[model samples]
Target: MSLRQTYRLWAPMYDVFLKPATRSARAKNLAQLGRLDGLNLAVIGIGSGLDLDWLRLHARPAQCIGLDITRAMLNKAQIRRRDCPFPLHLIEGDAMQTPLASGQFDYVVLHLILAVVPNPAAVLAEASRLLRPGGQILIFDKFLHPQQKAPLRRFISPLLGLLATRTDVEFEPLLAAHSELTCVRDEPLLARGWFRGITLQKHPINQHPINHHKD
Candidate 1:
């Protein structure tokens, strides 16, 4: 089954299984935004709009856009949008390559998405592309440390990836590919460090000092 089909079936019970386990971590990850007044934010792979309530409580962004591939998931998010005070727009679209304009957002959230997508690097690159320079990306998902031997996880990653999420993804290599993004904070959140909360900031333009020489 395609990932979208898998998630379409999973959407009905997604919150039932995920909400309890991820509630605290989600709040903690969103907290990193630290009062987002007048900032434009995008939540890529915003499954079931679980983050909306937290955003409503913690931030008053100028606008927040959520994109997801599954219509069933977007339907759930639509229901949750009614209570959100900030402007919330939900789009049924792919995370790897969104239709949104480039460098228009102040922040991007990628909770529980990296491991779920087929090309995590592409999604990360897309998120980076969507952000304005100096904007930050907040990620909360599971990752494996380089050279860590987890035979079972590596073995089952292929099968699990088809149905849900990948277990063998390494964060370092993905981050390394995007030189413009700098890791600011990374900490373990759940499952004995299997799941992590990471924050990345896109480097601003013209960082080098300009030399002023009079001829």
Candidate 2:
């Protein structure tokens, strides 16, 4: 089956598979978006609307767009969106291509989607293209360790990528290298830097230099 087809088969039970993230347990390691009082945002890969539960509490974005490759995912999201007090837009599209006007968003979030897509960089590049200058991209997913670029990881990661991920990418450099965006902060899982929550601000080249140094 194709990548999306795999998900479509599981779409009926997708929400049952995913749940309200445990706060002090597995959830603590994920991204913590403090507050979004007034932000124009778009979320790529809004799988099963799990993040929407958290977003409803944290942000009141003017326009919240959720895009994904699976139509069933969008269907579930649509049901969830109805309860949302703010605007919620759903689009069926690929990660590499966002059907949004360039330079139109204030904030965009990948929220762990990169780990499952076919082209991680292309997804991120599209994110940059869709954001207005000074807009930001927030990413949360598994990225390879900086010091330990093991041969084992290189081999295993791609195979895993074939099943459920796009790139077993080194996201730190990709976020750092872009002149239009700056990696302001990175929150890592306690023992491993493999999974992390990242904040990248687009354009004007500004950041206070986040310390991703291992503890």
Q: What do the candidate models score in CA lDDT, each in turn?
A: 0.90, 0.71
Work out how many backbone clashes candidate 2 has.
1
The list of candidate 2 runs beyond 4 A from truth reads: 20-35, 150-153, 205-215
lDDT of 1 by residue, 112-213 (tens): 999999899999999999998888899999999999999999999999999999999999999999999989899999999999999998887444211222
Tens-place lDDT digits, model 2, residues 1-215: 56688778768987674563323223443234434445578888987777777666555777888998889878888888877888888999988987788987777888767777766778888999988776778887777755665677678776766655644577856666567877777777433656677777776644322222221
TM-score for each prediction? 0.94, 0.82
Model 2, position 93, has a per-residue lDDT of: 90
Model 2 scores a C-alpha lDDT of: 0.71
RMSD of each: 6.2, 5.1
> What's model 1's TM-score?
0.94
Best by TM-score: 1
